[model samples]
Target: MEGRIAAKAEQDGAVAAPRRAPSQQRSRERVERMLAAASALIAEQGSDAMRMGEVAERAGVSIGSLYQFFPDKRAIVWALAERRTAEGQACIAAALKDVGDAEGLRQAFSGLVDIYYGLFLAEPVMRDIWSGTQADKALRELELADSRANAEFLVAALKRLRPKADPAELEATALLVWQMGEAAMRLAISVDREEGDRLVAAYKRMALRELGDG
Candidate 1:
């Protein structure tokens, strides 16, 4: 994954802090359960409609326990966002690990898109977090910043694929690709299943062409 991307996000203050850090395995597990319950609520309703007490109840923890990890809905959302972003980065890293040619890159990109699409479809919380981020100014800014970090990761991968390419151009293209993928994802979810598959395929073609491939 893009190890530095998350670090850069933290450095830039895009991440929100939890009420307390999970220090022990048990604490971490408790916090995970709380977040999981919160995710279910956010997925069922919206983040604004999610209640802390209900989250604790669903998690089988006390209300105080929920507050021990997350202070508010915003903190829960941020943690979820961070988790999702990390998963996406891991997908990209795994997909590109064995890529050696344009065809390989295309396959890897396709895999990356498929993984993200599945994630969003399977987890309503992911969709909610993405939509929420776009609607909030501060979150929108953070999303854009994270996009850039993801782009830089892609730039590094592209350099491996095409070492002769111009550095500046590669950087620009990577950012464009990353943003395009995001847009495609938004559209994909809003449309029917078959159409969404076609849309994703089209995006793969465009991404490959922009990367100086098919």
Candidate 2:
């Protein structure tokens, strides 16, 4: 559950950062190719079985070049996961903004659930990457940081909805909602599609009702 949004301290050795940051356009393009290759391999098989050399070969880059940007397979997975998280953050911002009433808030909550669930269903690689986070403490920490970031977006919206509510209380509520929502999504993906949709719908209804009460 915690690994869905997983930890954020990138400096930890467990996940392994890129050997060097790509600054130039050519370097960035190469990094993107490496990521795309790794993502495809992870989707085709699993991160546990994806080999660095294969990724490099698929990307049409040398193995040395792959290692230059990603020290190991975990780093590649982390990059892909982090990129997806960024996309989620943007979606969260868009879905939760401009809400000033109960109806609007409910719609926003629904949007959040639908958008995230859609992503999980559409992108199989995310499931594998998130699962890996549970075993890697560094990746888990990365998720925690990401969870907090997502929670902050929720808090911002909550602050608007509950002007008189204590800030600390709202922050706590935001984190709780986010983590549980992530857990729900994780669980939803683990089951059949029909059951998964039902689970997502149930969570959305429960969340909307609870937040509506606030």
Candidate 3:
């Protein structure tokens, strides 16, 4: 079974998708409960140590019911990861929606970094879910696509602020900066709080400086 799972992971890039998506409202709510339970357990124990049986127990669903929705632990993890990614993308969209001037853009850009970082910092499960994606090709592809999607918001803001800016340049710049910001944010959270603070502050300064100069 382990060998088969490894083979599937290599072949599909993602672990496994949900065995079945919920079709009814009741089924949806039950699935949500299962995912919520899984998230909490992941937060407490890390995804690697979390068990499917524990998730079923915590969600107050039978093992059979859980398996009906998710074929394995990886499916649950992927579901949670997808939810987090969507939330992150929505957060970015909202953060960059309003920009009146260069100063406003700069503040919004720096503020966005803080806001997104705060989400990951507050949710330990976000960190664990993120690490869970590292070994999968599909999730890695998803991450890159997500970066581009998120960068569109930033680029839109830039186009509004600098009406004369080249569209291609703005796009490439936004994509690079957003990707770097994500990497830096991950780094910022991986260390001691004091040092993390320093790193975040430095990243904000550098990013904001670039925004100002552009």
Candidate 4:
């Protein structure tokens, strides 16, 4: 009986120890710190200047721990882009929910432009990632994929608002609107608020005209 009890105890000990809940919390906190550090660094110095050691130092984590969460700066950049894309997509979707026709589309388009530009202004690092040429192949691919997805979403929204429109023409128009918005936002980053507002207003008018609402 003593031998059987000892064997059972050993078996229990051999089983994997259950992770303490605090351990998970600590891990999450560490990741958040690293991400925050990376964002600040990227924002101040651009993505090209980001280094693993700097990130680790800023994050207050060991280099090994940083690697445990992110393999490289590109991974951090990708994470940042993905997060912003999700936020921007949600904002656009919500703002356009009640929009059903050309006028509504105009309002939604302007709203989307404002939201997107606001997000970029709020996170300059995102603008760097979008316009930077120093990204890795995988990061570039991810960026392209994100842009394509956004274009598709815009096309779908436009089609819904203009059912009688040619699908190909609508897609082309959507791409034009997206490109114009991106370009205008890039220019707005270096300009004053009044100038940015004027540019956005002009683009909104042009987009409305393209949609046959003007």
Candidate No. with top lDDT: 2
Candidate 2 lDDT by residue in tens digits, 117-168: 9988988798887766678887677677777888888788888888998899
Error of 2 at 34 (Å): 0.6
lDDT of 4 by residue, 18-105 (tens): 1221258789898889889999998889888889899999999999888876766766776676667667666766776666777677
Give Cα distance to truth, residue 24, candidate 3, Å: 1.0
In model 3, the runs with Cα more than 4 Å from the true position are 1-13
How does each model score on TM-score?
0.86, 0.92, 0.89, 0.76
Q: Report the poorest 10 consecutive residues by lDDT, candidate 1.
A: 1-10
What is the TM-score (0 to 1) of candidate 2?
Answer: 0.92
TM accuracy, model 3:
0.89
Query: In model 1, which residue pairs have backbone atoms overlapping below 3 Å?
Result: none
What's the CA error at residue 28 for candidate 3, in Å?
0.9
lDDT on C-alpha atoms for all candidate structures? 0.78, 0.81, 0.79, 0.69
Query: Per-residue error at 39 for model 3, in Å?
Result: 0.8
lDDT-superior candidate, 3 or 4: 3
In candidate 4, how many Å is residue 11 off?
44
Cα TM-score of candidate 1: 0.86
Candidate 3 residue lDDT tens string, 49-149: 98989999999999999999898887787777667777887877887798878888877777778887787789998788666555767566566777888
